[model samples]
Target: MNHLKFLLAIWKANLQSVMEYRVSFLTQVVGMMLNNFIYFAIWIVFFDRFKDVRGWGINDMYVTFGVLASAFGLVSLLFGNAFTLGDIINNGRLDYYLSLPRPVLLHAVSSRMISSGMGDFTYGFLSYAVSGPFTWDGLLRFVLAILLAAVVFAAFLILVNSLAFWMGIVSSFANLMLNAMITFGIYPITLFDNYAKLILFTVIPAALMGAVPAEYIRSASWQILAQLLLGAAILLGLAVTVFRSGLKRYESGSAIQVEV
Candidate 1:
């Protein structure tokens, strides 16, 4: 309960900060929405010419985008600092977090907010509401899927960024891995071969971020749900372990006199 209150207060402050620059915030939101729309447009055109790909159709694509966008957006909005973990670690910004009373990893990952993520969240829910099944079961599935996907995405980013602790200045590698996950997650998973599928489920785990949850929503099965939940738990545990292990190697630069 205390941690939840702290998180809420931080989020409220972030919201206020973004609102201070209303024009920039609104522009970022609109720009991201337009950018996502353009990507969806390409698929629309493709589907117009070719009806389906490997049994996946436009509706499946809708769910895919919905899950991916919402998951990514939630992480960006609530835990935006995780996306820049490598830079923070490499630049010695972890000192600021270490000074705080809260959990260092949580504090570091939730320190910043991404304003553009609002657009992605809005677009994702709207897309799902329009194309997804309108039943209670559908809504429950959608919510669960989005939550699971967000967990996987956050864990993956943390895992990748934690590498900076061992290998200094790994921001580029972290960014590349994050971008690859986002790019591949938005597309249909069926396009991949067996070996690629295995990799997605294991090393990269892109499928868990979006594809698996989307599949569960399309056809609700206990097996897929179990897989998604178990994968999320394992990845999250691994990320936490990695971050904590790396913290032992953290060397503070003490460049700035930061209170928090």
Candidate 2:
């Protein structure tokens, strides 16, 4: 109940802040949607030339990408502002958060919404609806996959943000990592070579975000379900550990007053 109240307060504050700039929020949301639409368009073009790539068809890849992007979008919508945690640390702006009676990381990360992420969410949901092999079981599996994907994706970002403790400024590095995940990690893992596949499946586990989850739904295997759960747990654990450890080194900066 306490945690729920805290979360509600954070969400309310975010809504108030967002309402102050409604035009920018709406513009960003539409722009984000358009950006993802282009990627879907690219896929259509690719599959036009070749009916199937690998063992999967266009529809199969669409479902995969849609699930992955949707999962990512949900995380971005709620905690996308977590990216700025690093900046707060660097500028000593964390003093205020530290003085508050709550978990600093939670408050800092959930402070704002990503208006653009709504776009990603829309594309993902539409793709899932349109690319129907939909059954009750498939829908259940898809829900589970999205939940796990959000956990894994958020852990990945938290791990990246924790690097701020050492690097002091890592916006560029963080952006690069996000790009790598989208460019290489977002696609099917089976497309890579044996060694690359091993890396994607085990080391980074990017493939599991979509490829493995899609396979589990198609085959309905307990083994895949177990692995996905384990992967999500491991990532969440590691990210938390790193973040907590990193916070020990955080030094608060002077808060400069600004004229509004």
Candidate 3:
């Protein structure tokens, strides 16, 4: 109950901050939409050159990307400040969070909102809606997969941000991880060879977060379902462990300095 209230407070505060700069908020959303549209266009061009890649047609790829992209947009919107965790740690802003009664990780991240991500969310959802011959079962699977993927993705990002406790400058690494997940992880893992498949499905686990869940929606295989649940469990467990471990290393700071 207390956690729910804290989340509500964070939502209100974030909404107020976005409302303060209405023009900038809208512009940012527009810019993000254009950026995402360009990327999808490039993928379309690539498919035009090649008929199909690994038995997955261009349209199938579109649905997969759309689902994952929508889930990613949602994750970023609610947890946008996660990327700034490194900066917050470096500058001692984490001190304020540590002092708060609620979970510092949740409070620190939930306080900010990303209006730009709404554009991405809209684009992905529209793509998914348009490029579909989906049945009721397929739709249900897709929705469930997306929800589970969002949880795993959030856990992964939190795990990544926790790196700030040890390495003060982690922006480059975080950006690299995000890119790799989008580029290599978003595509169908079955297209890759055995070695590459192993890396994606295990080491990075982008396949589990995006591709595997997508496959389950498309084919409803029991194997795929099991993998999705297993991946979510592992990712969530790792995230919690990493976060708790990092918290112990945190040191609080105050702006008021004593002059020697």
| Per-model TM-score on C-alpha atoms | 0.96, 0.90, 0.89
Please report how far candidate 3 places residue 139 from its true position, in Å: 3.3
Question: Per-prediction count of colliding residue pairs?
Answer: 0, 1, 0
Off-target runs (Cα >4 Å) in candidate 1 are 257-260
The local lDDT score (0 to 100) that residue 73 gets in candidate 3 is 74
Candidate 1 lDDT over 110-154, as tens digits, reads 878899999888788877877755888987998899999999999
Across residues 157-232, which tens digit of lDDT does each residue of candidate 3 receive? 7778779889877888888887777787657665799899888866577887777777787778988788788888
**C-alpha displacement of 113 in model 2, angstroms?**
0.6
lDDT of each: 0.89, 0.76, 0.76
Q: Per-residue lDDT for 213 in model 3? A: 72
Worst 10 residues of 3 by lDDT: 251-260
What RMSD does model 2 have?
2.4
Point out where model 3 deviates above 4 Å: 134-136, 256-260
**Top TM-score prediction, candidate number:** 1
